[model samples]
Target: MVDWIIFLPACFALNMACGPSNLLAMTHGAKCGVPFAQKAAIARLIVFVPMIAASALGLGLLLTASPFVFGIAKAIGAAYLIWLGIALWRSAKTLKSEEFLDKSVSMKIAFRTEALLAISNPKAILTFAAFFPQFVILDAYWQSYAMLGAAFLIMEAIAIFAYALGGSVASTFAADKIPVFQRISGAMMCVFGTLLLMAS
Candidate 1:
């Protein structure tokens, strides 16, 4: 049996972490709107489900054992994040001249960005592999893991909503200063990329 008391809080904490993906959610929410961001954020869960399944099936451990593979994954992720940061920074200039956000941001673009960001982050898989096992029961391994995965997805959805709401609220207040918000988000993304690169 899974320990709901402990696992719920811990899992929620992990979901609520101010990670790249969550930051991206906030950025999207500010740029587009909460409803648009929430819809796009579903792509994260789509990617995570297979990742969690893979972790449960033990491929996460195999990948972890291979430093070469892990390094490649981390490098790709860091590079993508840095590139995204730079792109956003450059785009901030264009946003400043306009009173409204570029409504040109389509659902497809947002969906793809969310999906790629989630997929590129190797830590997502590692998180599932490392964190889920602690709460899983050996005797009912599959059942317990399934339950944990469901719980994680639920908590993740809530976290996504919370972050999106926060961004939405901020954007509402800073309606006249959207460009400044974009610049800050862009800088944070760059910092996150650099930190990910430096991580052991």
Candidate 2:
């Protein structure tokens, strides 16, 4: 029941801030030069699914609860979104130096980094809980919830993939222009943060 298209951008933005994905991409950009696609896919696989499941469960519980609890959850979720937006905005301006980029980072390191990032991201958890049930009709069968869940998973998968690919391609062309890339990526993060605040 949720507008899958509308939810895609929010999901993408939330995932973009994911520490592992961003760190891996930044590390690769700085050192071994792995394609963004590879990094993104790994990030998505390791991080997204578990978060999505956790979110679905949390959201489902909230939706099934009383109106008061639901309202409290919404408020908490909104405030968290605002905080996340600010944090991301600040991160936009801080670029890792080439020296930092030159360090060797293993896939295992990348996976652990992403896992921690995903686990600690309260915004991601609340967003999934708050936004997912909007499409579910209470009177409808349980199948409605299942459908929405599947739709969200698919949308998030595609959006994260595209973002990673784009980042990889853009990073390649901007390889000679690291400063520019950093600035642009930073600005984009700020913009995403702003959007999240506005949406909340």
Local distance difference test, candidate 2: 0.51
User: On residues 53-103, what C-alpha lDDT tens digit does candidate 1 reach at each position?
Assistant: 999999988778888888888898999898898888888887652444555
lDDT of each: 0.87, 0.51
Model 1, stretches more than 4 Å misplaced?
A: 97-102
After superposing candidate 2, which stretches have Cα over 4 Å from the reference? 1-36, 39-46, 59-104, 139-142, 179-200
Against the hidden reference, what TM-scores do the models get?
Answer: 0.96, 0.52
Q: Write down the RMSD of candidate 2 (Cα, Å).
A: 6.7
lDDT of 2 at 112: 57
Q: Model 2, residue 104: what's the lDDT?
A: 49
